[model samples]
Structure formats: structure tokens, C-alpha cells
Target: AQSVTQLDSQVPVFEEAPVELRCNYSSSVSVYLFWYVQYPNQGLQLLLKYLSGSTLVKGINGFEAEFNKSQTSFHLRKPSVHISDTAEYFCAVSEEKTSYDKVIFGPGTSLSVIP
Candidate 1:
């Protein structure tokens, strides 16, 4: 079984402040990790992924995450946040290699960047 956990359900921050979203996962087998962002009334967009590469992965909008195999964690971070960055973020995991593999997503972390 594979599962994802987002420690914080909601994060509030002032504009231009730094923020971090914590995520953890558990899988019985090798897995692929990903972080996705969802804007209001829109589908999710891939933020970053940890397929098979260096632990550090950068994503759009100045977001980045580090894959810690030992801890089974992939925490997303941003140096500075803007009001436009307010959105829901999801952490996901997949155990299969094919594109058709099922992905398990965390409950999602809502980021509220105040102006």
C-alpha cells in the first residue's frame, strides 16, 4: 500500500514571507513522488517530481522540494511567497513505472498568502 500525508492542512503567510509545507509518504515498494498545485476552480498542475534523480528538485514559481529517502519525506518550500501563490498543494506517490499507474494524493495543503 502507498499513502501520502500533508502535515499542515492550511498555512497562512504574509506576502513575501517564506513558507514550507511538510509531506510524508509510506510505500511498500519503490515509488515516484510528486507535488502538485491547484488554483481556484482549476485542475491540478504538476509542481515538481522525484522520479529518479537528485534529491533536490525545483519547480515553477520558485518552489522546491527535497526527497529524503531515509525519512520518506518530500517537503515543499518557497523563499518568498506572493498573494498569487495562494493555492492548494498536494503530495502524491505512485508505485508503478507506467503512466497508467494509480497515484495516491494527500488531503492537500491550502496556502493562504495575505496581502
Candidate 2:
């Protein structure tokens, strides 16, 4: 079984400031990591993912993350943030080998970008 952990519950940042959302996971075997964001009253949208290839992956909205196999972490970061970036971020882990595998999601980190 795989599980996800989000280090912070809420992150308050001023506009144009850099921000990082920490995420960690534990699994018996290799798994895929992902970050998703949700806006007010909207469904979750994929931010980035680490399946294979590069350890560093970039996503939409100037967000990026690095997959650290040693640390079992996939932390998301943004060089600069905007007020519009305020939303809930979730970290997920899943094993793609099987169709029955479940995607475990973290509690979520609420990013409050203040102007």
C-alpha cells in the first residue's frame, strides 16, 4: 500500500513571493507522484507528475517539483506566486502497474496568497 503526507496544512504567502509545498510518500515498490490543485468550487486539476525520465518536472502556472527517491519526497515549488494562485494543493501517489491500484491523496495544503 502507498500513502502520502503533506507537511503543511496551510501556507500563507504574499504575492510575487516564492513558495514551496512539501510532500512525502511511502510505498513498498516504485510508484508515481503527482500534484493537483483545486480552485474555489472547481474540481481538482493536475499540476505535475513524476512517472519516469527526469527527476525535475515542470508544470503549469510556473510550478515545478523534484522527485527525490532517497528522501521519498516530491515537493512542489513556484519561483513566484500570484493572488490567483491561492488554492488547495494535493499530493498523490499511485502504482500504475495495475488498474485496481488506488491513488492515495494527502490531506491538502491551502495556499493563501495575499496581496
Best by lDDT: 2
How close to the true structure is residue 85 of candidate 2, measured as C-alpha lDDT?
100
lDDT of 2 by residue, 1-115 (tens): 7889998999999999999999999887788999999999999999999999999999999999999999999999999999999999999999767533688899999999999
Local distance difference test, candidate 2: 0.94
* TM-score quality measure for candidate 1: 0.94
**Tens-place lDDT digits, model 1, residues 17-115:** 999999999976778999999999999999999998799999999999999988999999999999999999999999865433699999999999999
Instruction: Compare the candidates by TM-score and give the number of the best one.
Output: 2
What pairs collide in candidate 1? none
C-alpha RMSD in Å of predicted model 1 compared with the true structure: 1.7
Candidate 1: lDDT over CA atoms?
0.93
lDDT of each: 0.93, 0.94
RMSD for each model, in Å, please? 1.7, 1.2
